[model samples]
Target: MDIKQRILASSCATRWFLFGLVLIGILSLISSEWLVPSIASADEQSGRYLSIWARLATTTGLVVFEVAMTTFLLAVAYLLLTPRDDRSGDVSVIEGSDVGRSLHEHLRTTESYWFKGRSARWVRDVVFPILSNRASTDQIRINLFMALPDPSNVKLMKEYADYRESIAYKGSKDTWTQEIVTTHILAAIVSAYHNASKSNFLNVCIGLSDWFPAYRVDITDGSAVMTVEDKNAPAMRYTRTSSFYSTFRADVEHTIEMGTKLPKPVSSFRNRELDATFVNEILAHAGLSGTLNGAVNEESILKKINNSGQLYG
Candidate 1:
């Protein structure tokens, strides 16, 4: 039935029930007066007092009955008027936009990038350690985002321990390690695009070397050398150096050539064929193809030296 019809029916039923109960109670009280034997009295005063007491008792019972009926009727009315059943089916998909808008507004009101108050402690102690130990292969990758102010731009640093533990000892290599390293390298390349001038480039190089002391860095006008060292013994190093890049043409060539030597572990999300497709996708994103022309491609590489002399495994 419709809401209005249901409410009307319930109200009518409740009124009738209350009327019947009141009528029965009144009849019982009247009957009690007639059925009870009169008490012997020494005077008319006692008789009068007894009649008054009976009247008062009957009034009290009627008052109680009225209060109970009123309360019941109010409760029934409330239930009948209240909504029932889920409205989920009636809601449109577009209705979710309002919820999203509200959440966005709330975030905007409370948003702050700088840690303050209690959050400062977490940022200092917790986040720094977690960032330092992110890689399972005893490597920590740090990315310098493009938006940051230079003297430091387009910088990437990796600090790793020079040891390989067997998988049997629960100290094995993880499959995701290479992928994580690649991501950090990719982030550094992306950051380089933001620099408006080459003056900041040298500063960026210097900042990276300082940030990751484990990696020995030697930067010249057109070439750079980076060496990843053993954590236990800093004296030991695995070095990789790039050839001269006089122009952007030379730089692009060196970046791609260096990228080729990087290890590609089995991707969790892609099969071999899919992985090939994904690599092509990244190349396309970087606006790089297999062939590099001297003019259009700003960078060119003269040579690359990978010093594996100290590499144990």
Candidate 2:
């Protein structure tokens, strides 16, 4: 039967069972007074049986009462302890720049970046610059989670870019379309991840999946970066940031927990596929010619950064 029917059936069964027990209990108590006198007059063996039956009935009745009372107590406790629905989403807002600053200040930090946006250009624009100017003592452990570049996601992003261009710059001669920009940012992030893997200063993990949410969270050692995507805006804003141990932090943790539980990409580190075909496609699409060939020389990358001008520190 369906859920409602099953629920009704179970309720009916429970009610009847409880009613029967209550009736039996009342009868046993009433009968005990008269039965007790008869038990003393009956043969010893019959008297023993009657005594045992009476005790069993009394014990069963007491057990049912206790179970009912305990359930009531638990229901009351749950009502008292649970948070109100109105305040469930009550996370404190933190500026995106402030979050960027926390990453800049920490010498050693742990972080996770989760996103389902086109290219995640913000990382290259905001995150990379902070890391570039870090002190010699600075180190970062990062877990980068991105939505798998499936056909549907690509189509969605392209449509979004078209809408953005129509409203933001209809007549501009900009070479960077939404698709190209998104690929570029993905390439930049991946390139940085590769370089970090070669260094003691940064440790990185990557998870690719098609089931990511359209939000971004960067959780570091002492602070968290959180934002919800606004479809109407040109970009998503970092809406909340808090201590790593705050209630907001707990919500971020839950988000991470859900993300990790999804199926990992087939060409993942877990599967020992270091140079996955998917990774190469992203780099190639971004026009990073030699990144797929493991030709990323440390000195060359440093020089490129140096030529890029003012850092964000």
Candidate 3:
């Protein structure tokens, strides 16, 4: 927004105007508190004209101080009485830079959240913060609907994962294949299970399905936000009252059908570290079972997530 547009924004303009009123009041109070008193206390030994002028200045300053303070109070009252902007059914065209903030704002207020998307290294960026936020709150459930890497769609899934890996900053990712993609999803499950173990509030659930959503959709009780995989398009926010929200909500219901929930991987784990034994359990849960199978080593996946970073969104 340009300076003129910013100055004309209802909230911005009102806030700035309130600020101006407070500043004026503060200046006037300073005059009355110190400057005016000094002048009003001027010595009577001085010329009569000087003393009278001092009294006049001090009196005017006092009146100005009172008026300024009264105006400031009235401005506050006006703000208090004003109605807030009505945004029911309004859809927000969220800029790319604002996606995470928009998501966080909605997530914080969500009673339940539904995230449907394919695997991408950036998935951590989307999920971990909510886990952190939930750590301090009453329990909130985050249901992750991941694209299942089954035989029917494994090739397509691999291509999708490769494309996702391509976009991350250089030296931070690998040319992904079926095993790597599976391992990455495994990492997310591990992360979720580990965090869930640490707190009662971490009600994170992971489900996998053959359905690969075209993009990412975050559905909350009150709103639904969608973003494209490449992020070339802007994010969109749909309020619960909007028709679009119903459509997306229905879509989420449909997408979740036949989904497989996490196998809970060994029933218990005490830490976040990845080891050969832990990796075997993760694969066995995914039905790969016994040894590394085709999956990359736990060390490689660990380095990819820690040093290179990002895993899914």
Candidate 4:
């Protein structure tokens, strides 16, 4: 049956049941001598086991009253304490660490997940374990829509970096310069993809855009998790059945479409043939120089994945 029909069937006479219980409890509490005419109470209920039981209850008086009152109280308490089940398309406003948790849950699922953000550190961290999974190998496809680390946009990236650094992470007093942020953004992307290449079953897609998003969006086929820059602020959660989901999906699509794909380096990495030379070629495809910082800072992040199997931190 549907939700309404099921509700009706389950709660057929709950109101009446509550009403009767309350009335019985009140009547029993009164202990009126005239209302239950003492000895005649035995004669009033007779002839069957149930009637005999009723007579016994009548004789017992306050005991039966206590049971009725307790039953009512317990039912009310149960109703107050029970949590409702999660329904499809429900929206939950969550905050802080919950935002990271929400993204983690979405990406962990077998279904497709799309990510668009500045530095996808949370996404990268969650994706590593999934890439190592042997059970669902080659079954999952993850899309990372990242901002291109084009050297020409370094000036604009500095502005973005300043804005991002202004918001403290976990109450940290540390600071990041524009080069640090730029290298980090570049490192996070390259490290995640290079590591994923080791997985035979996982497919990682990279799409680079010149523009940076104001917020982060991690969405699956059914649910979308979005968070703003303020770590203390609440994040938004929505399902495919919502307008937010539809609009958000469309927005995700448009943003990704605007991106230029970087497939060669990822392909070469998967084939165990990726190097700084090819890395430069990949960057050049996106209008970036491989010598961005003379292959020391951001370019070196790929070596960690190659040598130690550690993600860019």
Task: Say which prediction, candidate 2 or candidate 3, comes out ahead on TM-score.
Answer: 3
Q: What is the TM-score of each candidate against the true structure?
A: 0.20, 0.38, 0.56, 0.59
Candidate 3 per-residue lDDT over residues 53-119, each given as its tens digit? 6578768767876787777676654554343322333577888677766676766666566667664
Q: Which residue pairs of candidate 2 clash?
A: 119-182
**lDDT of residue 180 for candidate 1:** 34
**Cand. 4 TM to true fold:** 0.59
Question: Each candidate's lDDT (Cα)?
Answer: 0.29, 0.43, 0.59, 0.59
Whichever of 1 and 4 has more TM-score, that candidate is 4
* Residue clash pairs of candidate 3: 120-312, 121-311, 121-312, 122-312, 123-312, 123-313
Q: Residue 77 lDDT in model 1?
A: 52
Question: Model 2, range 1-313, lDDT digits (tens) per residue?
Answer: 4434543556554454455557656655655565554555564656454467776776566567656755665454333333333134323444534444543444244354443433444554555445433422455445544433322245544655565455453334444454443444455444444444343444333333334334454544544444443322231222233223355445544544543322322223222222445355434533443432222333333333333422112
Query: What residue runs in model 4 are displaced by over 4 Å at the alpha carbon?
Result: 1-89, 128-152, 264-267, 271-287, 294-313
RMSD list, candidates in order: 25.5, 14.7, 10.5, 8.1
User: Which scores higher on TM-score, 2 or 4?
Assistant: 4
Instruction: Rank candidates, TM-score, best first.
Output: 4, 3, 2, 1
Worst 10 residues of 4 by lDDT: 304-313
Candidate 1: worst-modelled 10 consecutive residues by lDDT: 299-308
Give the winner by TM-score: 4
* Model 1 bad stretches (over 4 Å): 1-48, 51-58, 77-313
